[model samples]
Target: MEISRSLAISSWIAMAIVLSIAPAGCFYLPGVAPADFQKKDPLMVKVNKLTSIKTQLPYSYYSLPYCKPTTIIDSAENLGEVLRGDRIENSPYVFEMREPEMCHIVCKITLNEKEVKDLKEKIEDEYRVNMILDNLPLVVPIKRLDQESSTFYQHGFYVGAKDQYSESKDAKYFINNHLSFLVKYHKDVEMDLARIVGFEVKPFSVKHDYEGEWMEGRTRLTTCDPHAKQTVLSSDSPQEVEDKKDIIFTYDIEFQESDVKWASRWDTYLLMNDDQIHWFSIVNSVMIVLFLSGMVAMIMLRTLYRDISKYNQLETQEEAQEETGWKLVHGDVFRPPANSDLLCVYVGTGVQFFGMLLVTMVFAVLGFLSPSNRGGLMTAMLLLWVFMGIFAGYSSSRLYKMFKGSEWKKITLRTAFVFPATVFVIFFVLNALIWRQKSSGAVPFTTMFALVLLWFCISVPLVFVGSYIGFKKPALEDPVKTNKIPRQIPEQAWYMNPIFSILIGGILPFGAVFIELFFILTSIWLNQFYYIFGFLFLVFIILIVTCAEITIVLCYFQLCSEDYLWWWRSYMTSGSSALYLFLYATFYFFTKLEITKPVSGILYFGYMFIASYAFFVLTGTIGFYACFWFTRLIYSSVKID
Candidate 1:
């Protein structure tokens, strides 16, 4: 029995190893054939029109191969190296026409025959010519005739650098030889070619820092090109060349005819879009929203109306009867909830998040946050969040005042600090870990400083100003007067219990968004593109409606149960969806991700906690205010004597 168990465990381990590495070798399988395996289609280079421009940020592997400052004075004359959320539509590089054809290779050497021969004798390193087009890396192919392996391509060459991962030295060479890269046509792949649409070199910032400048150029390549320099320029001054500050880059492009259409290049972005599953999610969400809306409408039009009419008529008769149901708790309903100060703080943060989401969606819908621009969406969100601090201050202060809480200063301070402070601390810790790893994705210290500046100089001040304005305004008046003593709560049904109700109430909101959540996770973790903001915006609206309607319905039920402690419960009921989001993230990590490192797992959960908390704030706020308004409207309509 022990031997059999050991064998079974060994087999499982072996299978896990194979599965982990399977994706890397999948392309080499016999079933995976070349593009032109059955039919011959001549390769062509097709140039695409430049859709957007972006600043190039240089990255190095594990902080190896240190970059040097460029001495090219004329380069980067008009370009800004550091990107402070600037659009590059006003770039110096000009692209007139885009077409695909065979490209002609041009090589001009100013070296004498003896010098060239001597240089060739000393050349020991394989020089790789790499191009950046649309911020995408293009590399020269090193051919291998192995039939068992898929065609592997390399983009960069080693220069006296050992393998950081293995700690093993591959090759060593002296940098004493003259180097030149020749443009060559790639004939291995059919129907796929590169056309040099345009090329421009300028001094740009490396790693989002202005401390070091890199003289890098991007050559726009399309899958089609026949060699002709219709508009090409190269700065080949002898002085600049002697300084070794300038590099002359030439490109040869070829195109291959393929069954794949160019229009469908972005088809991957359609993740769940335009599919039956997508429509099903949409239909499911709509049904829930409609059901809740109908419930709310019925209560407002029928039950509440009858209750209010009966209560008013009771007052006109000599034998006046007492009220029951939601009206019985009217006195304590307007009474400030326990810990109103904390609730006010949360309300403020929720308002801020609400504004941030609205502005971000607007910008995304307007195409200002296109995925092609890289980091544009995040940049926009951060900026909008900073500016929307005033909303947080205003909303929190007003709510605190409505609650008759005199600690306006404390409310405003916590509103500004509590959640945002937690987020920033977590971000800093994560960033520190990334920096320790020396990963290129690590946010630089300077960038962190800038963020701090934006927060304090802009967001914080705005919050204060908003708080002042909100405090100066009159406090919100409640429809019913508060009794000196609180009303005794009655026993409730199991369904009306806070824990049970919150658990049940959270499910619908989670259901409304789980499908979309999957696609969003794919985009984030799988590196897939997500550009269908139209559908996203629609889903956002659906989520809002779902939260509001569900919260209102749930609040009504709770009030009907004579539980006036709906302040925190209302918020938690809707915000509980974020708990499910965290659960989904855990499931996704175990099933979808092959992350084997302990550090990665920890980081994943850490960041996920921050995300879940923020989501809780956003959704919880929505439910609270929705219920608040509903309570106010219903109570105000009734005549109390």
Candidate 2:
């Protein structure tokens, strides 16, 4: 116990030291807190990527032949931003606090044949141009009467729509060159200070006839003039994207003082998806699972107590010989199973994932990872996983030592590389697919190099150090001694068969969290924000409980069936949830998603496979430890000689 406590303390200190040395680019001091602004403060607008639900792809905003600055400098991004395909950069659009503009020309560009082709393809994919103003993403509010909420937002507006008003042999595409911006702000009652709270835009397609060539910030439009006692209205015949044709980009800005305070500005955006969650159904389902698990636990404990008492009150040694069932397998139970090294490796890897997820979720719940901090969640997950390699090494090496294995280094290497290697291979293939599509979703070579560097330099060294410490310590004593010859197992019931039993055991644990899984998947595939970490944390705890309980129940039954080979079986019993999870992902792709492109389909399954595999490791580790504890406690309580 003293050694274990010391190792844990050492791990914490090492983690803290490394984190303090890491960059703080992914965080804001007070994310979601108000940033005060003086009157007429210039608000620099930025452009993100062009997103499309149809293709499930995000292309750089400048990827299409759109208006651009003289030199398009890339925004500084963290590792997570690169991985998530975020390409943020400065745009020509600008605004000021408590100021408005009408019929402002951004740029005029002629569309060549190739540029026209690209634009049409984007429209075919139903792409929306995403823009950012004052760190707030521009959203187009869509009113709905289908649910309790009257309005939800579409993240960005479509570049153009085709063949809606006319049915020509060749689709006539109209581009949305006219943007009507609505900037919402909160004004301080005591002073003239104000803070930009919301940025929304209503996109339109307007064909403008200007008098002369205009330069940005200096030119005004005569077709839709602000001084003519009127402002621009979208033309009945909007600008059409055509080959060898010129198009003009224009915008209008309007400022409105909102009643909402600066601090509560994010309330509206968070509430946009309130209709997405069905609370009563989720709560009701979770309660049923909890109640059933409790009842099973109560009955199992009572039965175990009665059985132990009866077996212990033996009159003589002859009575002990006649005893059968779980007691009969006592000698073999403590014996190391075949291929115990593999089990240790898996359990250790699981420990690493478990630690990373636990810490990441805790931070998210405490508001350290707000949506305001773009890419913060993914960054935290990656960094936490890398730093947690120490725990993985320690756990696997310690387990290998207990299994009486001599090759501690081999086990440590497997723990450090095997799972990550598999994930990387899958990710690489999917990234290759995205690269072929020429989308921003493809991770850059430099970012990939950084990932490799982190794994090798920081994570590997930590693992080696942890393994050396863990392997040097004394191995834990087993509760029961193994016999020279293992006990023969009796014929087990069909339900106790490893394959059937493991799969069945997974059902309950999966049932505990499948509802929550829907929301998580929606957030990822639908490109929406998921900030309900508090509820998510609760579901995480519930999942842990379900996995532990189900595995313990199954282990007890296996032992009772006179089967002592419970090592691998116990891990798989809970880990089978991964299979179900992957299947559900496939189902979602077919039923919920409309991904037609083959590459997009491949990318979806590829990433989901990685996610499911991680889940397998995490839940599998939970079950293994729970079963280990149960066996130790039960065997220790019994009168074994």
RMSD of each: 17.4, 2.7
Tens-digit lDDT track of model 2 for 1-641: 64466457655764464344333423344443456778778888889999887798899998888889777878877667789999999988866777788887788889999999999999888999989876788999887878666878888889998977566657799889988888898888898888878989898887777666666567655557754323557356778889999888888888889998766666777775554354653575478567757865674678778778877887788988898778788888978888898898889899989888888888888776777667778877888888788888889999999999888889889888989999999999999899999999999998899899989997887778778888998998888888999777778788888899999988887887887888889889888888788878878888888888888888988988889999998899999999999999999999998899988888898999999999999999999998998888888887776
State each model's CA lDDT, in order: 0.59, 0.82
Candidate 1 lDDT over 15-98, as tens digits, reads 343223222212223463323212233322111111101101122321121221222111111111122211211211112222
Superposed Cα deviation of residue 118, candidate 2 (Å): 0.8
Strongest candidate by TM-score: 2
What is the Cα-based lDDT of residue 130 in candidate 1? 25
